[model samples]
Target: MSQPDTLGYLVPQFPGQTHIFFWREIAALEAMGVTPVLFSTRRPPAGLIAHDWSEAAMARTTYLGEVSLRRAARVLPRLPWGALLREAGRDGIAVLKDVLVCAAAGEALRDHCARQGISHVHVHSCGRAALIAAFARHLGGPGYSLTLHGPLSDYGPGQRYKWRHARFATVITRKLIAEMQAELPKDLPPMILRPMGVDTDYLRRDTPYRPVQPGEALRVFACGRLNVVKGHQDLIEAVRQLRAAGHDVTLEIAGQDDDGGGGFRLVLEQLIKQHRLQDHVRLLGAIDAASVKARLLEAHVFALASWHEPLGVAYMEAIACGVPTIGTAAGGVPELIDDGVEGLLVPPKAPEALAAALLRIAEDPALAQRLSTTGRARIERDYSARLGAEVIVSEMRKALG
Candidate 1:
């Protein structure tokens, strides 16, 4: 089958601070001669929209959270009551409530897709947005696909119902695929292993990466949301250990807390104060892609000690920019970085181990050069945004056929 002229791209809380990969994927789809109609459950919080493209993205997106009562009433009779009841029986009351809400949004989505001539949608979330797409399918709106970005548990209830109706699903890691196979039904939709990727072309460094000299401060860059599960506190402890060991090091973390920098940022600040890392560690507070790339280029090493990351695009961006990265050996990180080859991997929440890894990279220029060269090469070869886009389009073609 030939490619459709338009495709629907659905994301929950679209254009959030950590949604750069979705933006890159949309651009990739456009480059392949496919127009992506952006759909979101709702707009993200104003402060959490940090990217320069947030305004333009918001201007173009169609939000489905605002359900018209007239439309809901019109489509109410069309809902598959039998199937919904079965879903409730399998999942319970809470999921049924969410499904009902998404059913309303599905009615609106059907109307919008009819007006825009969108035949297929790819949901980038397995959360409520996936439920919206599923109900849209039930309403005869569009054939929908799903991308499982993390563990199914993190996406919330009704896992079986969400996967039952998808044309196909793309999981970020083989580990996640295994978990899905174990938890979900055997008669499930086709599952593809397509890890999230960064735009290597855009994330590449123009200038040469400079290693930390003997006297200069070892600039370390970490990027992720300021949450406890993200292990920012552990990274801070590592920075303190590196300083205590008499290595000149400075760390800059480029992300904000969920509460628009008020919630977990205060907690991280208190920890930094306890360690007396006020001068050595700075929270950059949710920087833009250009700023992150700039910092990656300037830093000697990049590190993020996530407690359990699905797959880290920040690590990809850093590696794509030729900065030797250090990620904890948790979740799908080992799939991205080899232990001692492309980048370093330390145990999660082990501040001493993280400190040792950082010190090794700072002390050894040869190891840093090898990791920098090989890490960028790895991204260019297997983890480019273009490659992921191609796989998605290919899968969409097969499904539509």
Candidate 2:
């Protein structure tokens, strides 16, 4: 009498919230009565490795190794060398590295899949995660699926064999789907627009957000890895301008400080001091999910001035919690926030624009309240995790049956 084996490929180690996604997805599928054996990688910690999810998701999960050398070789030749690097002298070498890497890792992943008799493999990102799934599926004949997000790759339409290994692909926004399709055939595998849904039970809109206490500096919260695409610099400059113009703003950043323990992090610290923002800016490195929920409750506004995003569940979660939002006009963000409705959208990399939007929200109580009320409604209606689960489950049934 042993625990039943019902799992598929899963990478519990991917960075940020994405690392937690497959586990959550498994839970959703289990709630629908389909158990999958987890093929786990190094992404998740040991304690989280063999988990019995809150909704009994483990009934459908069986952890698996994250490496396979042989399977990787099959997907290596398909790397869609970006049009920009099509002819680079080092491009071939780069492709060779990718081939070796995937062949090696994919071979291991495939072995685990075979041992479990798993019928399908689904990956959370189009980067190496999807590539590994693609390679494993190619070697073992599992119907495979991959989800795309920003930074997966700057792929052009039909550029290489990006999704060639997948039976179907899922992306979070129409905008991203369109960009990905640029490199795909006129008709790509049932590209589905599925927003990353939050655990509806954990995140809610019933929290109360109130007026800042007199002279209590406004707390502006931004989350995500401190990288160029996140536009952290733009936010810092905007906050500086706001303070210079006599606005009282307190900014708190939460994410990993990959700054040599100081890289972009040091630059951010230097900028804060240069702007004399020692009193206004604070850095909280990589807060957990519970802490993030608390911050969302206390936050005056959520700002993600990123230049690239596939679809930010962070923003959706904020609105779901009844907080208004402001983000840069880039990637799939527009597809999420209906400008002047759910949230305000500004030009990417424009500090002045961001500052103006922030100050406007700070000053307009009615507008903020209005957005908070209606924005949550939008999430409940259009972006619920229930919707994602249903769409993905339907697709999985079609593929598996």
Candidate 3:
């Protein structure tokens, strides 16, 4: 296990905000003299490669849609057809479709890795990409590993098979490790905790922890997709409650509509109007990384009442920038921020609890400042992009061995 020379990095999207953690990890790996080849299942939206870092990544990245069938055919003859067919058949039509696409992608990836001399593949999600990575490994290309970001419910039955086949796997929280261990077979690969994080330096604010002045409206900031799991609707309802209670509060939500075909955004918009929070809540759709940091700096409180967040990097960014953050005690959030230590944790999908938490922070500046100071220190002490990268690279070495 003398260090792996070349590794393949597989992701669903290449340069989107959701993949920012992967960008940081790739940068860290490059700093340590490892070669990484980026592979995306599809091309990102127009102009996503806006920043210098993303632009640079676009050069080394390969969009799997551009994969040629002629090249993929090289590995098809070597594939274990019986096992592959059985695996595909066990799943329904939906999974069979994924398997067909994944098998083709695997064949293409195998051919690409052979030419590049890549010995390992690391997929970012436990979804289709991981399935493709497992398929590629089964095609006798290279060792593979996976990182689980979303809830396990999102993954299909094939996920268990992928976990068993991966060389090693890492979940963003220890709770996920326990869940997977209990559900998966004993022969599954080693599962470890490697939490998602932010580059604190990138999110550094010139004036961290800005106290709200008298008569100034409190800037309540929340960032994430305008979808259900993020609980944006719940946050909006809480803000509505806060406004009703005679608190001068305005919430700025910064994220795109991740739901297909603008459905969820419409729902959120209707909720805002129904609650008459049109003036109180501003939907700033899809702000960049710089804008996110800027909003965090100008805010008195950062909150995301997500129902099931695996490990929110937005909370890390806000906490790193000294914003008194609040998150739901759902899915690895408590692992990142304590109830009263680093930040406040409220029950998920409870608009009343969310409003209470926001009200508490707004009324008590001392509590807000205390949480801000402690949260910043926690980010500095426990979370960093470099630290996460080092852990992942070390695990890759173990897998290589």
Residue 290 local lDDT, model 3: 76
Better of 1 and 2 by lDDT: 1
Q: Each model's TM-score?
A: 0.97, 0.83, 0.92
**Candidate 1, poorest ten consecutive residues by summed lDDT:** 1-10
lDDT of each: 0.88, 0.67, 0.80
Clashes of each: 0, 37, 0
Best by lDDT: 1
Off by more than 4 A, model 1: 1-3, 73-77
Better of 1 and 3 by TM-score: 1
List, residue by residue over 182-280, the lDDT tens digit for candidate 1: 888564799999899989889987887778898899999999999998999999999898888788899999999888988999999999999999999
**Stretches of candidate 2 above 4 Å error?**
1-7, 15-23, 44-93, 151-159, 258-260
Residue pairs clashing in model 1 are none
lDDT of 2: 0.67
**Candidates arranged by lDDT, highest first:** 1, 3, 2
Top model number, TM-score: 1
The residue ranges of model 3 lying beyond 4 angstroms of the native Cα positions read 1-3, 47-53, 68-78, 85-93, 259-261
User: Residue 151 CA error for candidate 2 (Å)?
Assistant: 6.2
